[model samples]
Target chain A: MFEQAISAMASVVVDPYLLGLIFATTILGVIIGVLPGLGATTGAALLLPFTLTMDPVHAIAVLATIYVSATFAGSITAILINTPGTSAAAATTFDGYPLAQKGEAGRALGIAVISSTVGGIFSVLILCFAAPLLARVAYEFRSPEYFALTVFGLSMLASISAGGAVKNLIGGIFGVWLSTIGAERVTGIERFMFGNYELYEGLHFVPIFIGLFAISELLVQSKTVDKIIKTVSMKAVKLPTLEDYKKIWKTILRSCGIGTFIGVLPAEGATVASMIGYSEARRWSKNKKEFGKGSIEGIAGAEAANNAATGGAMVPTMVLGIPGSGTTAIILVGLMVHGLRPGVYLFTEQVEKVYQIFGSMFVANVMFMLMGLYAAKLFARVSLVPTQILWPIVFALSVIGAYAFQGQLLDVWLALIFGVIGFFARRHGFSVAPIAVGLILGEMVETNLQHSLKMFDGAWWMILTQPLALMFLVFAFLGLCGPVIFSWITKQKD
Target chain B: MKNIYLVPLILSIFSLAVIAIALQLDTSPEMIVGDSMQARSFPIFLMILKLILIGILTFQFYKNNPKPVALEKYHTWGSMFLFLLFYLLTVYTDMFIGIFVVIFLMSILWGERRVWVAFLTATITPGLVFLLFDYVLKIRFPRGMLMNLYYG
Candidate 1:
């Protein structure tokens, strides 16, 4: 097995075309990653169709490269502009932009790049060494376990719902409801089509994701564009001093750990990982007051966690045929399209392919770090481009990307519709993340719940029968309730 | 009366109505061989949950009596809407014409009213997209009638 893995990793041919594709796609991913509204998932989704004709290995390499590099690249905008390029980078802006404002932008960028590289490399290594073991563990998960896991994921709404506990639950429940729009999964029943044939297949994720993230953001930004004073000058970038690095070492370590853990959980994407890492870092900080104001630790924790989350997310994706995040779910589609099934069998059966993927991810991380260091100043200048020119280009790409999804005009129309919906959602302070999370987890929750119920003759006790399921249920519940509990405790103390 | 909350409330209600209609059409079975539950189970569960959430949210809006802050100025909603409308119109039209015109018009909408700049953007953007998507990526786009004009 080790020999096979080694040979597979070693045999990855770095021909000129492959190298060029990797570099070009990695750069493209970085550019997309730097755009606040576009994320790794959107980047991957946009680029996915282009790879359909390429060799499966090459396609996997390109997609993996984009996925890995884009994950790290998002921190650039977050740190530089204080606007998170992807939801995952939200925590980075907590400290990253502040550091940029203080003229230590270079240092913050350097550390973010380095720590991200480290976290990514570390996760890849873990993936390499522990994939078989992890896959074996994943194999043990039954329907009940999966059902519990989905429940646990939904429990995360406590942290996500901004208005109140009830609001969050309502949002999550709404999300699960939305997932049911397509044709029935079990009995092939066509529920809720309203006689529109388009409704028969149910709501496509591409439209919903595009609507919630891109459209909603545009709407919100439209409302607040006046308040969005472009703050920093693009002139004279600064790097972190030695002292800054020394101070943030602990934060980087803690955040990497946090991110990795969050990443490992199925359906919890990098955004949640970064948020948790940032919040935890703040909680554990000796100088918590310095956090949102511009602490290096904040940037370090967030960037490290978000980057590390990519590797963590891949854990379940490559092992259990279950994706840990929305982006990975799309990646799962790509993997399946390439005829690669994600499971423990993949490691034993397609060890070479797995190794090659792992190897490509490592290379992508290194490339991102190099590009981030050498081209920080150039990328930062993107901010100087007026929204007038920039937005049109973005709109054009959005249209092209939407069409490219299935080469269908209908998808473009769907994207536009979603864009409008997204715009309004953003204006109302309703987060797109929960909607996304809901969309991703909706099917998982429903399917699993039904399966678990069947196993126990429709009895709820089956959920608690399996130790793993119970543990996940408890953990999810705690995760959901933790913020509220903490808030109440703090309030009492005060 | 603050009407801002009413918008989302109405939207949510509309969404629920759509969902309810969709659910009614979902007459699929409850189980298949390989997986645990039937096809309709998840969707039905989700629809029911959405109904409850929408109902609660609508109620919350009424109960809370949330006030509307003045919508921020400078957002060119009309321009944005026009841009979207033009984009949809272009989809049915010739690809080159659609791409060129939308780019030009969107540039104007975004406040780049310069004739030269608009002309440059309209032409260059499609050219670049064609080169990238068609030539480099090898993904064929809808050539529409422009295919006969250019290739034939």
Candidate 2:
């Protein structure tokens, strides 16, 4: 594994094409993240089709690099404009804007960039070491275990949904039902096709993602195209001095660990991780009063955790075919598009590919960190682009991206339909993340359940014989219903 | 008419329709000889769950009877008409032309009166995007009535 990883690193260094693509994508990602109203998920979704023309190594590298840098770039806007470019950067705004208010925007940005890079690199290292070992353990899993795993993945809908649990779960189940359209894979029966030929092959993931994440957002943004307030002139991005580093080094390191841990959990990605990390940093700091008022530690903690969560999110995505976050869900689709199946077999059969991913992530980390360090002032201007021009371009890209996958007009139409649905769903306070989760894991759930039933001759009690499956089933149940149960108990006590 | 209650009402109807359709799916005995859960089982289960959720939402909305959702400065029908018009044009015309016309018209209609900026934006942005696919990346896009003749 080490030899393969080393070789992959060497290959990345030698291949100027890949390095250049990584560099360009890193910059693009920063710009995307720096822009308010465009998050990592949308950024990744837009660039997804662009990666189709490239080699798999370069493709994954570009996307992964974009994912990492974009998460960090959000902090720039969060600091400068008091509007978080991404949801994960929302916490950064607490102290970040204040630091800018105090004329220390440069210092705050420097700390944010460094902390984000460190956190990202730290999580990548964890993904490097942990995914392979976890893959080995995952090799032991079969039908029953796999079914339970899918359940656990689905149960993550509990945390991801922004509304009432019931509402979110409904959205998730709706998406799963939608995935059941077209001919049944195992049964060969035309199930949900309303006689449309397009329904014969089921809903394509990429176009749906494009419509839901990008187009829907455009529609919503169109309704509320207000004036952007680019009032503050961004100061130079100053590199943190040795004293600055010494002050928040421990907090940054802890937040990296915290972010990775949260990220590894299904559906709990950067936003939640950064929130937790920032609070944890405040809780531990001796200077707690300075948390929301120009605290470098606050910026450090949030930036580090959010960026770390990107790498941490990759863990489940690579090892188990379960997406750790919405952005990773898009990355999962990208993986499937590249003809790469992400599971235990992927580890053994495509160890080289896995190593290549780690290598690419490493390069992306270094490149984006350097980019953020030097060119932050230039990139900050990206946030100020008029919504008039931006949404139109996004619409154009969405139309083409939806069409590129199948060369079919049907996909584009389907994207349009989904875009409309997604817009309403968002307006109604229903989260799209749950739908993405459900759509992604629907196939896995169906296949595994079928396999388990077939393996045990319809004996549902066989799950008791498998300890790991039983544990996962228990976890799944608790995960989905835990919040409801907790709320009820609290009410009863009151 | 544009109340918060309409959301749940629409959802319940959609869910009911889905359930009705899912139930009509023919998963006969022979098809499910070995397995327990049929193809329709998951869909039916999901639809029922959705129905229940919609029911809860409907009950709450009616009981509380919240104010109609006020859309701020929204031209709802206009935007919807534009979306439908633009997407329909995409299928009939060249992809590039469709995009340029849609964005330019939509932006102008919504706001942004700058002619050169809007014109350049509408042309350059969509042109570059689809051109990457049609030319650089070698992905196919509709040439429409205009571009194919020029190429030929």
Candidate 3:
């Protein structure tokens, strides 16, 4: 495996075309992430269709670079504009913008880029080692185990709800229902095609992701096109000195751990990770009150944690075929679209690509670190482009992106319709992530459950006897009920 | 906020209808090995799960009086109308032309002050898209009457 990984790394380095694709995606990712309302997920979605034209390894390399760089670029707007370009960067704005206000914008951005790179590299190493070990165990899993795993994945959505668990479950199960539209694989029976031959293969996930992530945000942003947000000018990021790193290395390291662990947990994303990191940094700092007022440690903690999450999120997504967060979910779609099935098969049969993915992420981290140092102002300026102009271009891209893949006009309509529905769904307090999670895992769950039932002669209770499956189910149960129980415990204390 | 439950209520009814359809599906096919868990099994179960979830959500919403949301100052009506109009035009007409028109109109509607900005965006954006997706990537886009006339 080590040899294979080395070969993969070497291949990626020597191939100039793949390197160029990675660079393009890295650049595109910075621009996408510098704009508010477009996160790594949106970056992944907007670029997904273009991947259809490339090699699978290059496709994922593009996606991985985009994923990593976009997460880093989000901090640019957060520090300079006082508006987080991505949800993960929201925590950065607390101290990041404050530091800019104190005229240490260059220093704050410097710490951010440094911490982001460190955290990113730290998580990529974790992903490289941990994912293979986890995938090895996953290779032993059977139908019941898969069903249980899918259950665990789906149940994570319960905690993802900002509205309520019930609402998230509703969103999730409805997404599964949406997935039932295609023809049944075994029986060849048309389920919910509704007379359109296009619907026979199920809703093409790329367009759905694009529409949900990009177009919905576009509609929301369109309403406020006239309002302009103020932004501070930034010239360049001051590189962190060795003494500076020596002072805050502990916080950066701890936040990387915090970010990676949080990211590995299904549905818990960088936003939560960064917040937790900030809190922990505050708790452990010698100067506690200095946290929210342009503390370098604070920016380091948040940036490190959020950037580390990119790698942490990919572990579960690549190893389990289940996303740890929304951005990873979009990347999973890209993987599947490129004819790669994530999970055990990925680790076993397509292990080289997994290494290439890690290699790509590593290269992206280094590339962004360099880019942020030299071109910090360029990305920050991208944030100041008028939303009306930027969004229209994004909208045009959405049309082309949806149309480019599969050459189907039907997909364009699907994207258009879902864009509206997604806007309404967001307004109605439904979590879109759960829906996407359910949609992605729906087939896997159904197929596994069917296989398990066949294996057990319809005795569903036998799943209780399988140790791994039972353990997973118990964990899923705990995951779902933990939030409510915790809230109740806190409420009782209150 | 008064009628916020309308969406949930409609969703609940829709769930019931889906369940009804799921129940009517064929259990097994002729080519199955050893009578496998058939077509309708998982669908029925999933729909039932969804129904139960929707039921609980609807009841919870009914019990807790939802707070009145202060609507945003800018209503999305004009923007939404423009979106739908552009979507339809792009769907029926050629993609390139559709993109051009939508960008031009949306730029103007969304307060891109300079007409030159609109013209430049409309003309240049589609050209980039065509050059990239069509010329470089080899994905063929729909040639609407505009492109057809030009080519002819």
**lDDT, candidate 3, at B7:** 71
The local lDDT score (0 to 100) that residue B34 gets in candidate 3 is 47
Query: Which has the better DockQ: candidate 2, or candidate 3?
Result: 3
User: For each candidate, what is the lDDT?
Assistant: 0.71, 0.84, 0.84
Docking quality band of candidate 1, CAPRI definitions:
acceptable
Q: Residue A213 of model 3: what lDDT?
A: 81
lDDT of 2 by residue, B63-101 (tens): 867666546455444555667887667657766777778
Error of 2 at A264 (Å): 0.9
lDDT by residue for model 1 (A280-361), tens = 8788889988988888777777788888888888887778766677677667767876888888678778888899888778
Residue-level lDDT tens digits of model 2 in A73-120: 999999988989899999999999999988888898999989999999
TM-score of 1: 0.85
Output the better candidate (1/2) by lDDT.
2
Task: Report the error of model 1 at residue A337, Å.
Answer: 4.0
TM-score for chain B of all predictions = 0.70, 0.81, 0.77
Q: List the residue pairs that clash in candidate 2.
A: none
Residue A354 of model 2: what lDDT? 79
